[model samples]
Target: MQPLACRSCGNTVLVAKSSLAHTSVQWADSSRCVEFALAGSLTERAVVSGCTALRASIEDAVRAGRIEVPAE
Candidate 1:
């Protein structure tokens, strides 16, 4: 579970891989305090923007230590 920082936005991003072919991401937003999910192929790059509310909700859950990543 290595953490990544977005170069453009400086957001904290979490990356995890499973048996499935896609990679999952958890991105953090400080303004609204939430984390957002972005999933896509491992071979391609993923970009997320313009979903502030949703991202903030997720970040809030993560900040409260409520997010659960299921076992692969």
Candidate 2:
């Protein structure tokens, strides 16, 4: 899986066809994450900001070598 850097959200959210059950508040594992979509009930900017923070956290995990995600 090719990691994608979201320019608008500044996140590397995993892109796949999946359901909410397979995802989480924090997608530490790319293999488990599906693509991000803006729900009709939410604003685009809010999602973008949240995703930015999420990406930063994931980056932090990588820097600390604490993430144990399997190879995709």
Candidate 3:
């Protein structure tokens, strides 16, 4: 896993990308996510999908060579 910070909220999370279609994120404290804490109705969805801002951050990190993906 690699470390990445969300561009929108500045929350740091661990990210791992096995392929273009697969990504895994590990957060030390999910409750600390600003977006997640503000997601009222979407709380359940947030638990499953995680913060969209973080997702985009992971993608950007991958593109910027900050994260590595295994070759298939």
Candidate 4:
């Protein structure tokens, strides 16, 4: 189990690997409802670093002309 901050209420919540694969994210403080699921291939550290890596990939694809962003 690991203590992860709730994305909703920012409370420190202990989550077991089993729970990450099953139930929805329930905030200890009950602020927001967040739906969650753990990818089988993701490690805890990979999860922590996910957004940064995802953003970098998106940006790189755009810069490389692989992804086209339509004008707003």
Best by lDDT: 3
How far residue 65's Cα lies from its native spot in candidate 4, in Å, is 0.9
Candidate 2 — which residues are off by over 4 angstroms? 1-50, 69-72
TM-score of each: 0.34, 0.30, 0.79, 0.30
C-alpha RMSD in Å of predicted model 1 compared with the true structure: 11.8
lDDT against the true structure, per candidate, is: 0.46, 0.42, 0.79, 0.36
Q: What's the true lDDT of residue 71 in model 2? A: 41
**For candidate 3, lDDT tens digit of each residue in 1-72?**
888888887777888898988998888766667767776555564555567788878888888888998999
Q: After superposition, how far is residue 66 of candidate 2 from its true place, in Å?
A: 1.3
What is the lDDT ranking, best to worst?
A: 3, 1, 2, 4
lDDT of 1 by residue, 1-72 (tens): 546454335566675544234346664543332222342332222343434543454455445544444456
Best by TM-score: 3
Superposed model 3: Cα runs more than 4 Å off:
40-48
Query: Model 4, range 5-45, lDDT digits (tens) per residue?
Result: 53343444433323212322223432221222233332532
- Residue 9 displacement (Å), model 2: 15
Model 4 vs truth, CA RMSD = 15.6
How many angstroms is residue 57 displaced in model 2 relative to the true structure, after the best TM-score fit? Answer: 0.3
